[model samples]
Target: MFPYAAELIAYAAGAALLTAVGGRGLLLISGLGVAATLGVVGPLLARALRGAAAAPQPAPALT
Candidate 1:
């Protein structure tokens, strides 16, 4: 799976930069919202995938 967390962090950093350039509070809030959602979802998906990765999969027995 792609690193959604990294993408979200990039988006947040970009937004912060833009907000600073424009001195806009609304942009900051919007960026924060996007970052927060990404933070919540990325870990949840990673945890779900981690379980799958740890599951026992059928493997050929080497004789």
Candidate 2:
């Protein structure tokens, strides 16, 4: 779960910054790694974070 929204957003900003003033080739490789990492982790992170901000649920009484 992304408890810290600012921290989560910083990565994207940093990547954009890196791409903005960098040369080709190496930057492309770094970009691919970053994208690949995100592709792999993003969905799992979303699943784990699905109920992170939801209200607590009550348990049903067993008869």
Best by TM-score: 1
* Stretches > 4 Å off in candidate 2: 1-23, 51-63
Best by lDDT: 1
Q: Candidate 2: give the clashing pairs.
A: none
Predicted structure 2: lDDT: 0.78
For model 2, residues 1-63, the per-residue Cα lDDT tens digits are 575887879777767766776667557767898999999999989877886757577899999
How far is each candidate from the true structure, as Cα RMSD in Å?
A: 8.2, 9.2
Off by over 4 Å in 1: 1-23, 58-63
Model 1 vs. true fold: TM: 0.48
Write candidate 1's Cα lDDT for 1-63 as tens digits: 369988999889877777676647657777899999999999999999999999998998999
Residue 12's C-alpha lDDT in candidate 2?
A: 76
User: What would the C-alpha RMSD of candidate 2 be, to one decimal place?
Assistant: 9.2
